[model samples]
Target: MAVSRGCLCCVKYLMFVFNLIFWLGGCGLFGVGVWLSFTQSQFSSLPLSFPSLSAANLLLVAGGVTMVTGFLGCLGALKEQRCLLMTFFVILLLLFLTEVTLILILSIYHKELDEKAKDDLIKGMKDYNKNTDLKNSWDNMQKIFKCCGVSNHTDWHNSTGTGQLPSSCCRPGTDPCHRWEEPCYEKAKNFLLSNITSVLVFGVCLGIVQILALAFSMLMYCQILRAEKYMD
Candidate 1:
């Protein structure tokens, strides 16, 4: 069955929001990448849980690139420019690719860190054996570690005391035998790091969908133009 131009226009109009948001979100993600590229310290804080500087740096780069490309996509959407949308799609696809790898690295790191921390606490406890405060201290250490699960990295203090410091564990090697190796809420921070990748992936995928929609709309518009010329 033949579709009327009016019907086609209605479909495109309905898709407008989809196109608009895809570009806007894409741009924001790209901006993050730019910010990370400029500030080494911020980059270091990122992937925020990975020990390997390389992994952290890579995530930062991915983020910055995604952010910039995404922002450009937003501009293209606003302008309703086809070539620009295509360019933005390429960058968005790259962003998705990087995000996939980042997810793998993150899973590996999280598992490894969890094991290492458990081993460290166990060994530390054994070393303190026979010190009358040993059991109490170990128990307290375990408690502090558990406390860390609830907190975020930003709240952790590099302090010997957990007093008023959120997520700051018992100062490691110190008595009451407490210490924080990283910031408090190490788990939450790791979750946050991984969460970004998940979100960006979903966003890029949505952008892809929007691009497909735009492609169809552009094709329809071209067809209409051709049909009008032929009739004339």
Candidate 2:
């Protein structure tokens, strides 16, 4: 009984520490998701759904689930409650499955999604001048990405019905002929792709953590049951 108690204590603290780290990671993910959502809101006119916005939404969901799971795990470990421990395990299992499905779908439809996003962005460009929010967003994106229109500078000509490119399309004090030749869509796509990759990696890591958490929770739950039986 003494050895069992010691072992249980060790496992309890281990679960607590693990969950604390998990919760912190979830907070970071949530913060990044919120930032992305705010920045991408300017492009809301593009489409109801786009890669960056979708990714932000994904992050928010994943983060919220992770935080909830982490909290359950932490409280269950400290209180040694079988119900909370089981709930944590169930939640983690569901979250893991959901992540796997999303990743698979994203991998399969990546090209199609990219094309859709490009089409949407190009379509939105037509209203660039007419929509203050979109215009500012485009200008901000161009400046940040150091790129011009969707496909290239010429795209603006069609969208604006004017040959003049926005000043954001070129470096300050540079000749108009020297406007950025890279497409804003490509740059933005690449940026979002890199972030998605990071998210994928993070998801895998979190899945592993969840598996460990499940193991720990079950182990402690069984130990608690055994201790109660011993007392009886």
**Highest lDDT, which number?**
2
Write the residue-wise lDDT of candidate 1 on 89-205 in tens digits. Answer: 566666666666766765778677655644443343333334535434433433533444223322222222233432224544555635454432354345445645764676567
Across 1-232, the per-residue lDDT of candidate 2 in tens digits comes to 9999998999899888888878877886787789879878766555645667777887888788788889888999999988898888788788878878877887899888778877877788788778888788788888788898877788888777887888888887887456887888788778887766776677667777777787888889889999999999
lDDT for 21 (candidate 1): 55
**Candidate 1: minimum summed lDDT over ten consecutive residues — where?**
152-161
Q: Which lDDT values do the candidates have, in the order given?
A: 0.48, 0.81
How far residue 1's Cα lies from its native spot in candidate 2, in Å, is 4.6
Q: Stretches of candidate 1 above 4 Å error?
A: 1-16, 23-71, 77-82, 107-232
> TM-score of each candidate?
0.39, 0.80
- Stretches off by above 4 angstroms in model 2 are 1-6, 34-50, 157-167, 174-178, 193-203, 228-232
Task: Identify the leading candidate in terms of TM-score.
Answer: 2
